[model samples]
Target: MADRRARIVLVTLSDSFSSTIEAMAQDAALAIDRWTPEGDQSWPDATAAVWLLAGGEETAALDLLAELPTNGASVFVIGSSTDHRVAAALLKGGASDYFALPGDADVVRRTLDRLVQQEGERQAADSFADAERGSVGFASVIGESAAIRRVVEQAKRVARHDNVTILIEGETGTGKEVLARAIHYHGPRAAGPFVEVNCTAIPDNLIESELFGHERGSFTGAIAAKQGLFELAHGGTLLLDEIGHLPIELQAKLLRALETREIRRVGGTKTRAVDVRVMAATHVRLAQAVARGEFREDLFYRLNVVSLRVPPLRDREGDVELLAGRFVSDLATRHGLPTPALSPEVLSALRGHPWPGNVRELRNAIERALVLSPPGTLELEQLWLERDDIPAGDRAHSLLPFPAPLENIIRAAVAAMVELTRGNKSEAARMLGISRPRLQRWLSEDTNEPTDQ
Candidate 1:
């Protein structure tokens, strides 16, 4: 499969232009499929497509661009129009590149060659990564509950189709990325890159450049041309983690790139085409955000085309003990300690407690217990279980009036959760029952607040 010849699809209404492109493709030793506008046509198995726009055929070209199945295939448009606006419109509509008719065949050939070479390199890199990671199937997901099984089955079905956009919604630490990776490794584009970008981690000033690449000297600090996550994810999947945190301004640009299958780098005049599947994961309900005007309604519709919600830990009945046992064994092995058996009482406690932080919290708790316990059967005392076992006296003392503002108390609690989770912000946010962004804002405000003299 790696040695298979690259294929090209040529769409044209002009016989002369068709002859010219066919000649160029033939000279380049590439397989080509030629189609005309007079009939309905399906793209043959091709790595790239070239659409020739004829005079007074802008509508037809735009229609074809909209109708063409991207499926990680690059599509370019060629026309005789010198109007910069026309070219811009075509590129924004979905054309990878818009070249004037009687354009340099050498440049087209060179571009095609580059695309093929880059694909080959990508395949080689994917092969290496796959080998290192092994196979990521539905089984890798750790849960036997019906809800989880149903999600896995749906993911398997969707993985069979390569071009569908997927939106995954869940509470933090519900394994959204794990599910995304499972889909990618099992899909048609499994032999490509799987790039991930966290929306909340990047600053607003740099988000665009981080997503769409930047030209050398594009900004004050950019000294060299850099490829963005979208371009690097070419021929594979791009996981936009916490996409609900994306800024409103950048959301529009993101929608444009997803709609057009093309992106212009920061300070770049040329719009480059990218072939990548986008999978977005968010804890925030985007529909509500759309109503609130925090998220774009059009982008919401686009991303919500196919949505999957991951079930929280509490919702997966009887899975807690199973997951806890697995975590204990895995952590014990990693730490070179003997696996401890959970007492029936401990199992009961585990089953009763609601895991607000989901799998991550459970994993961390088990790891913490193992590190502190000696070689023996684990007792309830070894695990730091959150229980309602506080004595009446301690509970009464807890109500003592503290000389601190409500904001100060909240700031202290947030800091404590952060510390308890060992700097795991996502888990801290989940345990605090607040969004990560809100938690961050609270912490930021606390840091910036004036200290008492």
Candidate 2:
């Protein structure tokens, strides 16, 4: 007997036919609903439909079955034993299975149970595939290194909660967004959208309006009302990348929004509530920025409710070779090129090199080697691991002796500092013992000056 929770809809032309099926349905402990071919009625919400056909009624039953919305459920047919040909035709016309009149209860129950189990398995597979698709890079986080595993485990733990604010700190290209997506897609709000915005990319004047939205005629460019990221992310998660770059004035407004779970659009008097889980990622340390009076203390505490740090590639030992091989294989397959084997020298060079740009840089390097290397094992020379990979002019300045001109030396030092920090101006300034504005000025001056022939 099938479970009582399983529903069966009996479609027949005569009362006797309905009564017989209804009795069988009751014996199987299944919920039963009735419908007739001549009547115009809505489709029943059932797991399977049992259609009873009388002599010469097969044509009408087939027409009705064509109009019925099965909704992924199975449809079984019951017909006279003499009309085996008609029953076979019904099977061709989308019926799952056909039984002669006086159907066996055990046979029907077994068929329904099998269909239910198959549907459940199919739905579970789809849900898992959707979760994987929703994550960053549209795939699961890859890496077996202890450092990455710890970060991933912590993210999974944080994912159990719906609205806890999370702070992910790591150097640039450390897969902060990947971890954020994993948490959001695996969390309680897995069905919801995952919205992300780079705080550092938006202009200062527009950042506030971008986060909080704007009403019609709110500003010079506001011709129509628009919803903000927070509103769009309602019932989901919002990731703020490079959050440390958010202006101090707007930080207070963000803090208020977080505190009250509400935001007022730019130039709008009304405030609206939002149900978004906030996650922030930054390469800069907010604690240091707070001590330096660059970031707000209160907002820092608000976002740091649960801190998870993504380990840089350098610290995740042996992960380089794994990631490099993966990138090579992926790129080769994508481009229809034959996958090249990594020689011992190439592997040693990959392991020994300090990956300043981390995983992102490693991927780029692998991609370059795949395109440039021929149909054989990739060698160390093809890896391009020299400091002189910088601009030809900059290389000349860096290789110059100590007696070189002070101006050349300064420019060379700035270039070296920028490279060391993976082109991060803020970190370069900190390492050079100068303010960011001063460092920018120096770069501007250097760029404006003509290169010596």
Highest lDDT against the true fold, candidate = 1
Per-residue C-alpha lDDT of model 2 across residues 199-258, encoded as one tens digit per residue: 876889999888998754468976444568887677778999999999999999999999
Residues 1-453 of candidate 1: C-alpha lDDT, one tens digit per residue: 444555777776445466666676677666776666566776566455454534456557867776765565656775667687876677667565666666545556666675566656666776776773454566668899999989999998999899899999999888899999999988998888989988987889999999998764479986444568998898889999999999999998999999999988886666778999999999999999999999999999999978999999999998898899888888888988888889889899889878887987788777777787777556676566753465667545434246788887788778667655656778678766578887887777765533323
In candidate 2 the C-alpha lDDT for residue 15 amounts to 51
- Lowest lDDT block of 10, candidate 2: 46-55
* Alpha-carbon lDDT, every model: 0.77, 0.74
TM-score against native, each model: 0.66, 0.61
Local lDDT at 21 for model 2: 56
RMSD of 2: 18.0
Best by TM-score: 1
Question: After superposition, which runs of candidate 2 have C-alpha atoms over 4 Å from their true positions?
Answer: 1-139, 375-379, 387-396, 399-453
